[model samples]
Target: MAYRKDNLRTVKQAYTEKRARALGIARARLAELHRTIPELCEIDSALAETGMKLVNAITAGAEGITERVAAIRAENEELQEARAATLRFYGYSADYTDVHYECEDCKDTGYVGTAMCACMKRALSLLSLESAGLAPLARTQRFDTFSLDYYQGDDRLTMQANLEIAKRYAASFTPASESLLFLGKTGLGKTHLSTSIAVEVIDKGYDVVYASAPTLFLSLEAQKFGRDSDIHIEEAEDADLLILDDLGTENPSPLHVNFLYRLVNTRMVSGKATIINTNLTVRELRERYTDRVASRLLGEYLVLGFVGKDVRMQKIGT
Candidate 1:
């Protein structure tokens, strides 16, 4: 499996510590065994000697030495039984060698039979979450904190419809899911709905990349200007789900505009899921960006219009 430097460092450090702990446990167990029954080790040495004798006898002459070899083999078997009994007295299984590995196949490398190891994939996924800055998002917004009570009864039907759509969209998200475009005025729960979806998908173990348009675009611009465009593309292209919050908030340069188009197009063509929460209306989006951009979005995106009074304004008693 191909791993980035950071991922590799994390995995290698974790695996090394795990292996060390296992070895330490194995050593302590063996030390207890040797203290409790010192004769077992002696028997093991004699058994090894007898094994060599059997091999040497088989190589020399297979005729008269058969009886001697048989007697030695019988004695070795008896010693093995005695050793096993000693180990049983110490409460260790016969197969408890000095290697307490979690997986004997790849020894917890999480790979076997030419495929990514399940454990390794889980590690990579966790590292991806750390890389994507999801921890802060989870702490800031929570679904349980969402109050449908804030929705307006004047547009009760529209508000209920939007809530149900958000619920269903979050509930039914898959890797092959179509993109989403959340359109409405500011503070109408657009950010809340998208962040809620991000939480759900993240809980299901997908790597969700959640960042505002300004934050993401600034980072992309920095990478491009600093000669690190490849890093920008890799992150944008490879995330399982991309949540671009407040799309019209960023200062649009020609480089950023083209970058945004190519980023969205590349992800769409590759069938990766994207969720864009924008306060801009359709007409505004077309004017601010381009018709081609708006057209592609309208064509492929599952648009959900957030409906309600501005919750922020209500909180401020405006």
Candidate 2:
């Protein structure tokens, strides 16, 4: 799985800090033990010298090398025993001075040789989820957690199909994947499925950006007015998959309409995937977003219409 550059940097920094902290703690413990037990210090010093002796013996010559290495190993084993006994005699654990890593498999390095450790993958997934604005829904709104019980008859079949399509799209997502348009009323599982896709895509190591229509437009406006930086807009344009939720809910404005056109057109030209969730019907969308924006969306997007009662109300028996 590939992670975004920034996310990778963040994980690497965390690993560096973890490794340093573990080593630091171990050093502190060793210093404390040295101060308390001078005999332990002598034993550790002798054990440390064995490493150099072994290296020197190997480089010296092949003749008598095996015997020299054997002798060194015997001495090292004796010193290690002495050190452990000294620690135990002082009521300390034998491994008290050892660096205790959070993940011993990788020694908290976040990697095993050239491959990434599971710990690092999990860290990247969580960071991506948070950065994509899907952390809140990630726990309960995954594809597997989506319940077809809320839907009935044809609605259930349609939703099941949609779910399968979403899973397939996420499984094979790339920068050039097809854009999606989720047309449905509120609380019809559009947002949930979109969130599910985001979670899966992010887990697959693709950069995803999720933003509500109102929030996205407001951020764009802020950037235009010099009140905010343009990073948000850049991310929206450059993400491997961008999900704009709750379209047509933002306050109507000509400037926002123009921004919408630019955003859609830019991502389309770049071949970046985008998912737009809206309560507006096709006719209403055309009326609201003008032909320019609607044309690109209609011509290019794979539109999925969601149909079902509000799952939230069903759960509350309302």
Candidate maximizing lDDT: 2
Candidate 1 worst ten-residue window by lDDT: 227-236
The TM-score of candidate 1 is 0.63
Q: Which residue pairs collide in model 1, if any?
A: 110-117
User: lDDT for each of the candidates?
Assistant: 0.76, 0.90
User: After superposition on all CA atoms, how large is the RMSD of candidate 1?
Assistant: 7.0
Candidate 2 C-alpha lDDT tens digits along 111-166 = 99988898888899999988888889888988888889899999999998998999
TM-score of each: 0.63, 0.92
Clashing pairs in 2: none
Give the per-residue lDDT of model 1 (tens digit) for 1-318.
224456657876887788788888888876776666778768778888998888887888757787878888898889878878877777778767558777676676666887756676667656755666655655556566677778857565776676677777778877678898999999888887777777777555576777788878777877767854313557666777888889998667777778778988999888889989999989988887788788888888988888778888887994
